[model samples]
Target: MFFSKKKNKWILAAVVIILLLVIAYTGEKRERLTFPEEIVMYLVAPAQDLFTSLGQNIQTFFASISQYREIKEENERLRQKVSRVQEEMVDMEEIRQENRRFRDMLDFKEKQEMELLAAGVVARDPTRWFDTLTLNRGYRHGVEVEMAVITHRGVVGMVSSVSANSSQVLLVTNPRLRISAMSQDSRDPVLGFVEGRTDQREHLRVKMDHMPPEAEIKPGDVIVTSNIGTIFPGGIYVGEVREVDVDMFGLVKYATIEPSVNFNRLEEVFIVTSPVQEEPRQEEHSADGEDVPEES
Candidate 1:
């Protein structure tokens, strides 16, 4: 407290130098703790171990998340593959069914007695005004006017016109096409003619006219072509009887029939190319007027 300025400055400088030396000494020996500090570290060792284990668990959790993402992506790809395989299987089954149907058609063609030319339905007439269809066969393939067209199931139509390689068929639903029909049951009359109704609103309906009022055609009777038909062959199936109606005078009767052929789904048919066989005519005569009954 009594020192001069020069002595005071010397004492401040000495104090600063001593403070620097103390800081240096502490920094150097900080790593080598005293006995009490070592005892404190030993007491906290388990907590440090716990912290290390927790950090390792966090790292493992992040690694698991990355693996799970990869697995999910792989599963999605597998599902897509399964979906494609299922689609292909469905397509294959359809192809198999088509092949079986065609095979059955070939067998039916062989069993037929008449010579037939298998033809495909090329195009359907877009004009709704007429019941007509185009066939792949034409004049070049022996398809001619009035040639009966039929499939394995039943009658379809007749060739109405022809080109060099294609032909048009007048379906049974046409108002002009009429075929003489007969009933399968002997009880029903042996004579009838199938003609399209005047309404012709639907292709599924037809009328079996020229039947006697006493004829026993029933709702389930099967009608077929008669032996007298000039256009269609005898014994060819026409349709099934749906209902019967008598005339106002009860002199004649007509029946509504459902055609056996599904014209809407017609795809392939055969044209009858064989010669027509006519039934033999029978004649009877009573010569001499049978007045020979005088018996001489």
Candidate 2:
């Protein structure tokens, strides 16, 4: 076994010496590579080319992945930016609509006979839903109890209670409120008292009671305050006649009226002040002893 190991070592040394001699001889040559060297180079060339190409392909793939990630991040950022812009547009549109409504109200006030005091609705009577809403104005602003409150569409209510800074309005949609209503048509000559209906919720409607049997009430007929109306001003729009009903005796008739004012969407109102009739008052004071100003 020892002699065999010694023989293997000598064979390895001989191979190393032969490789050294071949390298030295090749280094001195200026001519083309020898046939053996050419064959060796040919065998390794394809592997070297494959390794260089694989490195280039790997670098390209990594670069493409990084670029795609950047694009995805940029797209997400753009989507968020668009969403914010749409939200802002919606808010601006809402503001624009509010301004338009206010403008229409201003125009309506200009057409009124009495001085109109514009006010915003601030609260509602919890027990009655939209039957009663509170206004930002009160006695201090010349808003008196029983004064008619109106909107651009039509009459809304009467000021039922008053405070220094706020007042409550009894909406016409309330069951308690009754107004003498008349048909706008000169031919029909329909007259009745209007009262609010509570059973329905979709639309604010009123009952026109004690309609005359001969009265020819019809749908789409515009109703207005009659001359008999004491609280509300005459000719103020009330509602449109919807359905007509007759009693079993055929002596009395009633009709349903769709109110012109949309109480559900009430946001603002104008209080109608009566014309000053009495001799100029000496001083203005509320029943509660708070000094107030006279209507201008």
Candidate 3:
């Protein structure tokens, strides 16, 4: 609707008066809020409080994430340290065991009268593990074919083949190996021949055969090398008799021998190079067939 001229002038005058009042109100400071100020604070207070709370929550979330990351790193470091310590303990235990073995071997070597060569077992044929062993010593170490191989415990085997740096030992468990053995009882010595049994290979047993039917050999009898053997030294321990049996016709007797050496755990061995030679004794005689007189 169109306003009359007088009305228009009155409207313009009212707008100008309102502008002057606003300018005066803004310039003057008051002790309490104006109606407009109160209305603006009422509208903005909840939004401002919400933004402040959200910011604090975000800061707390980031802090928690950082702490968790540090804890995870510490745990990882501890786990690695524990693993290294465990590995070191295992290595130390291995060294201790090895040292003990070496000491025992050295003591045994010193007590023997025969020329002994120390050698370590290095390998075995998977198919004939129970029947054969490979030694780290060979011709270069004075090892020779048919040489007797013995450990501190007892007889092991004989050297079958030799190389420049390694030798193959025919274990006492092999059927092809044989040793002349006898019972340890001097009063009733029971002579026999010991050889490995093909049928009893799974049990790692040997057969002491050729014992007379009337022989007094029985269970728990200690079998030892006899003077008849050219390869092995006399008096060397062979094994123990576990069982004795007579033939179907009762012509011969046999005994089951459990070897003194555990072939499965064979690690170190000694090769008999030769028997130590002894100096001949000189005989002293008196010219009168009486005690020799000492010169004063």
Candidate 4:
């Protein structure tokens, strides 16, 4: 085995020496052969083609990666642009809605004959438990305390407090609010007091008292201001009768009224600048059968 290993090493050395001698001979022959340049080019053409193909593949791989990165970056930029556009569209839509609301309020004011002061609802009480709203108009705008506030649809509230530029209104749905109202269809008026009840959740409900037991009242009867109070104007819409009750007491009947305006969704209102007068009083008959005219 040792002799065989030594023999193998000698053979490897001989092969190396032979390869070196062959290389020297080939180099000398190449210098003397003087082959045509075209022929040499032809001989090396396949090798050049193989190297070129490898280089092109490497370049194509790098180019494809760069193109992919560019596409990703562009896609990201487009997505951000689309998101910004969508947000702007939402803002524009909100502005359009607000403009429509203001226009509707202006139209309502124009249709009325009474002196109206337009005011925006600035804020709702932080404690929503109380049905009170703050308005942008106040004493500066001729919004006096106890002045009635209303929307185009119907009555909203009465002014309770005022500042130069702001005022608090007591909503009709408040438990403490009371107003004398009557049915529009019938001339006989009834006294009703508005109250906020949990059962009537979103509307101002009135428990009408002093309605004559013989009075004809229905569910669909329209209720309006009787002008019995000094605050609200006569003929101003108050509410519609929803339910009625007649107890054993033969003289009086009560009713539940659903206000014409939805207080929960109130936004803007008109304040009555001038005082509303009650119905004109008739002359009284004295005990001596003489007619007495009351001073206006």
Candidate 5:
């Protein structure tokens, strides 16, 4: 067994010496590889190529992940910027509309015979929004109870209650409020008292009651306040007659009126602090054929 081991060691030394001699001879000038070198290269080349390809694939995967994260962040930033721009646009439009409304009110205030105090609607009765509104002005601002509330278009309501800094208005759509009104027609003027409909709590409508039996009131006839009321100013627009009906006893006639003011969209109004006596002028049309409130 010892001799066998010795023989194997000598054979290994001999093979090493022969490999060194072959490398020294071919290192400078070699046309082709030896058979043993060719066999070794053939076995190692495929494994080397596989490892290199795997390294390149890992680098490419990491690069794609980084690029995707950057793209996602950029999109989120752009979305926020767009949202901010849209909000700014809406704010600008709202300011423009408010300025226009103020200009119209100023024009009306310049032409009025009564003392007009501008007030903003601050609150609304949630349970009776159509019936009542609260204003920012009160007795401190010359706003008093029973003072008529109006808009550029026409009459709105009456100040029902007052406080130090705020006041409540009883809208014309409320059943408890009443206004003495008359037809605007000069040739066939009819007299009646206008009051809100009891059954129309959800709707904004008023009825002119106590019409004469021979009253020829019809639709499209404009209604205005009469001098009979001590609270409401005379000649102020109330509404237009929508339809007429006979009483159950047929002894009197009544008419439904569509108010000139849109209560739902009321934001600002003028409170009549003091009014002077004036004759009701006939309703007129503008050059554009639009019905305009005749200035008193």
Candidate 6:
């Protein structure tokens, strides 16, 4: 009870002090309790400084957040741009490799001893089964009928027909195409012709005819052109012997040849021009006639 009484007395004293302060403020005639200018400065200046510092700190925090977001967004954009450029660089490298391969084919054609004409494969036979192609070069390019065409790999075909600016080539795989070929090791010649067979299911197959009975023909033997016909040059690589068979009669032997040039995938070819003979011609005289000297 004594403690409670003391608490009530303290509250009453606080109320009285507050009422007096209110009355003094309202009564203008009463002398106001004034503090010196120096004392006012000491009381209010610290509070103002605290409020100003809080506002400045809040602004700086927000600006820093905004700057971080901008930097993150820019980093993402730059990464995407770099990835796109890398993909384009890969595509350019592929194109460069393809161009190099085409240039190598051109160089091989240039190095050949034969007089050559270059032509691109423009079109293939509509009858997809036919081993034939149309060339961009023709009569206008001095491409003549029956001229042999070859790629860097090996023989491709012979010119079958010609238009003004285009020509048709009968591929080596064509059934009508025949070539005299011989083994590189023995130089023993054989006659081979393309056969349109479905067996062994390959790009091309040649039926070798008139293989001598005594000749030892084997698989993996390289076959090249012989001087039997005027169509292709002698010693031009044609194919390799893949298989051999002797008929029941035992009189004739046959072999299968795999062409060195893939007709189904030919892209470009070279046409060989006829070689000019530089030697002078010789003349013969009758028995009674005097030998006539040829003019210089």
At residue 52, candidate 4 shows an lDDT of 100
| Native-to-model Cα distance after best TM-score fit, residue 231 in candidate 4, in Å | 1.6
Higher-scoring candidate on lDDT, 4 or 6: 4
Residue 213 of model 3: what lDDT?
Answer: 94
Q: How many times do residue backbones clash in model 1?
A: 0
Tell me which of candidates 2 and 4 scores higher on TM-score: 2
Give all candidate RMSDs, comma-separated: 14.6, 10.8, 14.9, 12.5, 10.8, 15.4
Whole-model Cα lDDT of every candidate shown, in order = 0.74, 0.77, 0.79, 0.73, 0.81, 0.70
Candidate 5 Cα lDDT to native: 0.81
Q: Give me the displacement of residue 38 in model 2, in angstroms.
A: 35
Q: Could you give candidate 2's per-residue lDDT for residues 134-218 as a string of tens digits? A: 9999888888887778888887977878999899987887766666678897585787777777676633788777777878888
> What TM-score goes with each of the models?
0.65, 0.67, 0.67, 0.63, 0.68, 0.60
**C-alpha-based local distance difference test score of model 6:** 0.70
Model 6, 53-153: lDDT tens digits are 99899899998797988978888999999999999999999788667757877787677677888788999886746678999998988988878887777
Candidate 1: worst-modelled 10 consecutive residues by lDDT: 287-296
Count clashing pairs, candidate 3: 0
Stretches of candidate 1 exceeding 4 Å from the true structure:
1-94, 200-202, 280-296
Tell me which residue pairs clash in candidate 4. Answer: none
Strongest candidate by TM-score:
5
TM-score, cand. 5 vs. native: 0.68
Candidate 3 regions exceeding 4 Å error are: 1-67, 200-203, 275-296
Model 1: per-residue Cα lDDT at residue 282: 18
Off by over 4 Å in 5: 1-67, 276-296
Off by over 4 Å in 2: 1-64, 67-80, 125-130, 198-203, 276-296
- Pairs clashing in candidate 2? none
Residues 1-296, candidate 5: write the lDDT tens digits: 54379888898889999999977876857789889888989999999899999999988898878888787888898899899989988998998999999999999999887899999999887776358999999888988787889998888888878999999988887766667788997477787877778774436888888888799788999999887555667778899989889999999999999999998889999998985455554432222455422222
Q: Is 3 or 5 the stronger prediction by lDDT?
A: 5
User: How displaced is residue 157 in candidate 5, in Å?
Assistant: 0.9
lDDT per residue for candidate 4 within 161-274, as digits (tens), equals: 899999998777765556656778766655454444545454457555557787778888888776555667767787888888886866678778888887666777899887
| Residue 278 shift from truth in candidate 1, angstroms | 2.3
